[model samples]
Target chain A: MKRSNIAKLIIALLLAFAGYAAFFIAPDEATMHAIQRIFYFHASSGWAAMEGTAIVFFANIAYLRKRTPKWDWLAVSSVEVSLAFWSVVLVTGPIWAHPVWGVWWAWDWRLTLTLVLWILYVCYLILRGLIEDPERRAAASAIFGIFIFVGVPIDYLSIRIWRTQHPQPVLFGGGGMDPRMKAVFFFCSGVLTLLMIILICQRYRLEQLKYEAEELRIAIEERGEPQITQRAKVKV
Target chain B: MDAARAASIILRKEVRAEMRTRELLQTTVTFVVIVVVLFSFAFEPSAAEARRYGPGLLWIALLFAGSLMLNPSFAKEQANDTIYALRMAPVSAFSIYLGKMLANLLFLAITEAILLPVFAVLYNVSLWPVIGRLAIILLLGAFGLAVTGTVFSAVATQARMREMLLPLLVLPILIPLMIAAVEATDELLEASPVLDRTWLMVLVAFDIIYFAAAWMLSDYLLEE
Candidate 1:
């Protein structure tokens, strides 16, 4: 069995366990009840998304400092995974919100900030696509990524200063959580973090494969030779 | 050359070139005026309604107009290969960024100066009472815009779809600035206005942070 397959299977099992714990074991909230179950996945995905972006931020910095293709790969992979998790956050957020807040979307700070963060990363990907040269694409995207990350705090602060319709932070809201619920929350977080790692690893491997493919294509184009397949096989 | 000296030299070069044409300024101001006029016709709001929503509308114009002004800042350098020349110079790359940023800031300030009175008259909002505070907010907000917009302009300059890409890259990143600027302007536009120190601080902090980030990371952005 492949190591990658093993990791994926482990992640899948953990996700299922987390979901079961969230829906079955965790006591229903006194107020929101069943729908609040979404909180487990929703909030955990949010944390994973943030973790993904934070990795992207560091990957960007490392790429600039070391100029390694691996750092660029890390940056791109993390952002792509982060986007997937952020989509989950966006989707699940509205699901939770609609039942509780009675609206599909809230213009509240965190929600709005997350939406904008998603946009910024999407633009980051677009910027990368627009540049043809790989080195330039990596460098340009790193700079843009740093700027986007810097803007995150500013976005948070602006929303904080100006009170909006969004609910206050519930995770650390200092409101005591039921002990079992807290356990479930941390359990969900742990599972999601593992999921994030698995996604990043898979994506990073995809990037490596892409780099190899590009190199093979370039070698074929330059030499007009049949060496590409053998080289690719050895690389794999 | 020293960073400040290099920056001033780039600033002077841009200003001199801009003065010769005034293309960016004229087009941006015209665009802004047309936008304001179109909004008036579209909404046709009463004086009270105008006063309420006017600041938001004004900043929207400024945001779009500032983007128009910034798009050309680096794109023009591409035409003459002047960017290459600047890159080859023995100056810190940050100097080039700061210089372009300063030039964009000046152009935006000029646009705002023209648009503010026009906005005041067109929207029937009195500007005299809040001019000082309004200037502060505009300066801070515009500084924020120019910092982020200038950097994005450089990145977008190399894109095939440079024109469309500039604003796409800029607007999302500038939301914090927009929030601070719009809310601060809203406070100033109120009948019983009190300048929100918090929003002002947000604007100032963002400007400083953004400018510093651009300065520090700029060397990587312009690489070939």
Candidate 2:
């Protein structure tokens, strides 16, 4: 009944429709048939993950400039969400690769960059966990987030200059993709982006709630009411 | 005071302290020597094989040594709360970072200078032909390592599991530098040596970008 719930329901339906479109509406590839279908999900997730990184990059810079909790919250949420999508890309990549390339992994430029990006962000999370103070954590991780994002393009360039065996880009006028396949790919990408934004919103809300709970606990402690403090602690 | 003057003063202090107790340079050189020796034993490569693999091994050893040498850059500043004292000084924060990064670069370069002849003898690789070009690569690579290592050392020193934290935070970001350094070194160490301009450019670009990033972020980085 709520607006957000209604929106969620609509997105859920569209996601299912996207799945159906990817499987059936899109034409089969001439070479790889069913296995090639993974490309739709894999590429879309990669695009969404990249979008998430851009959000995180900007959010980190905003946090650094504004020194606000909301920007930090948005950053952490986007990072976790982007990491989830990247995991999907990494997983689906090898699944598609094993059969096609005769090997599951290659030191290709894109693949190596993806792995490095995942490691860098995972370290970001770990760094956040290590700092106990919330303010320090946000500031420190923002600095780190900006540092690592700056490295991403250089990492890609270095690896690309070293070697490249991954397939060429087909999405942006590079390859002769069927119009139906292109349409399905775009549909899937749009749905996935929507899903990512929704997930980030939900995660941001969770962080807000956690902040509120901490404030309440501190207030109760300041009041020196042990009994209600215990009750409040239990409720939290 | 100008940043360069403040940085020079801090650099003098760091160099003085190290000269009084040669701890980092001595330990790092010994550590890298052991690594080069152990690697030679581990691989026991023929002269031909060593020519192919020696550069990679040498860089890996230097990377480990640099990590070890860099760990105490900020950690030791905590022993007497000297970092806070440095912060309270009238100097800019970037001066502190620049001075410390320069100190680290100096230490790593010294360690590499000592280890090179040892590595050359053990690996049966001649360095006289490519020493000039190789020095350029080593300086650029070492500068990149020192900049990022000093920055991350500051970050890691504030965290739990500080020793384990530095490498995890730094190594991934240093991959491009590592790749470029190793590739350039490999080319120079080849039989018919010719310097590859591309990897050298990559090294230069990496150094400039990270150094500039550190300079820009120095204020935030040194804050409590």
Candidate 3:
């Protein structure tokens, strides 16, 4: 095993511990007690997910326009990372919402937007699956990826502008965190961002290997004298 | 020939082609009006509710109808191998883009024009200010749509899910135009002060930016 991979594993383990500490070991909230504390991880991780997805989408656009492979690798990795974080957000939300809102999922504005954003991205991955050609797949997904990103801010704004009756944001001004809370919050968010980058690197390397293996398979098949793709000819 | 004549020549050629069968204009307008009627029947006829949803329904109907018209524009060219003919012509692809854009603008405008009075009666809102705002926003919005649409249409043609992919890809980027258009329309209907000269100027800036983009990128879309 390489050093960076080992370090990434260490960091991942640390994140798990920190996340556990934030949830259980941290001091109780002044108001909502056990439930509100979930806000720390839920909100921060959700924000991180949004950021990662945005970066993935942007990299996809750059890949499409420039016809570069590195951007595609960057994109697929970040999206997978986002899917993981999205799970964190989704899991933590029901735990928090069940006590506060008295329901697991309501048609609230925040939940709706997150749902739309998630579905939009799931469609992004499905698009990749449906296409046969890599370049075409990349270009099509890149375009849709950028589009989904544009929808996110507007989705956030639309909830604010329209009268959907969703609750206004609870956390304001650095979430009104106490000193101790702020320290832990900053620690988790920072480590998670770095953790995301490391995760993306490893995932990207795997995707590249997969792409190469696919190329080799195609090449072996073409050795039987059939042209598969105009692009695979040169790349393989 | 002069620039006006050259542009005019392109416009004339496009208009003539559409007028011969009228498929482009006919299908778009028919579908748009039907959509408006369907909206009225689907929702309750509350004046306030209809007023709020009018701009959204109007723009959405035009967009979907416009997409229908746009698909055949390029795919048909590939059908008869007319794309090579257009490519071999002395005229620039930018000219071709502008010509098609103008035709789309005309078709969309006519749809709005016919629908406005009917929508007004159904919703109990005046159509004049909306028309003025639409004149600026629709042309600007349609230009952005056409610019991006033509480019994407070319790209989608090579892909498997051209039908589904085009709208999925387009709606996200076009949200800004929709927001701006709807905001402008809302201000016009309610006569708000927020949408003064600056807002109209925004519409102008958007138009110029996208028109220039269409001009610059038209060739990239045309090249094999």
Interface RMSD of each: 1.0, 0.8, 4.7
Expressed as tens digits, the lDDT of each residue in A1-236 for candidate 2 is: 99889989999999999999999999999999999999999999999999999999999999989998999999999999999999999999999999999999999999999999999999999999898888888988898999998988789889999879999989776889999999999999999999999999999888877876776777778876645555556533
RMSD in angstroms, candidate 2? 2.5
Backbone atom clashes (below 3 Å) for every candidate? 0, 0, 0
What global local distance difference test value does model 3 have? 0.70
> For model 3, how does the per-residue alpha-carbon lDDT over A1-236 read when each residue is reduced to its tens digit?
98987888889887887788677666777977877777778777887787898788779668857887879889988988887888788788888888887889876667766766766677677667767788767766675566566445545654434325435554464355566666666667767777777888889888887887787687778787645566456653
Candidate 1 residue-wise lDDT, B113-157, digit = tens: 999889889989999998998999999988988999999899888
Q: Judged by DockQ cut-offs, is candidate 3 incorrect, acceptable, medium or high?
A: incorrect
Q: Model 3: which residue pairs collide?
A: none
Docking class of 2: medium
- TM for chain B in all models? 0.98, 0.98, 0.86
Tell me the spans in candidate 2 whose CA falls farther than 4 Å from its real position: A225-236
Task: Please identify model 3 stretches exceeding 4 Å from their true place.
Answer: A1-8, A61-66, A83-123, A126-130, A143-175, A225-236, B1-13, B84-96, B121-124, B128-130, B190-220
Compute the TM-score of each model's chain A versus the native chain A and list the values.
0.94, 0.94, 0.84
- On DockQ, who's better, 1 or 2? 1
Q: Write the per-residue lDDT of candidate 3 for residues B103-162, one digit (tens) a residue.
A: 666666676677677778767887765466556666776776776666566656656766
lDDT by residue for model 1 (A85-151), tens: 9999999999889989999997887888888999999999999989887888888899899999987
| CA RMSD of each candidate after superposition | 1.7, 2.5, 4.9
DockQ order of candidates, best first? Answer: 1, 2, 3
**Compared with the true structure, what per-residue lDDT tens digits does model 2 show for residues B70-180?**
889999999999889988999999999999999999988888899889988888889988899999999998999999999989987788887888888888889999999
Flag regions of model 1 displaced more than 4 Å: A164-170, A226-236
Docking verdict class for candidate 1: medium
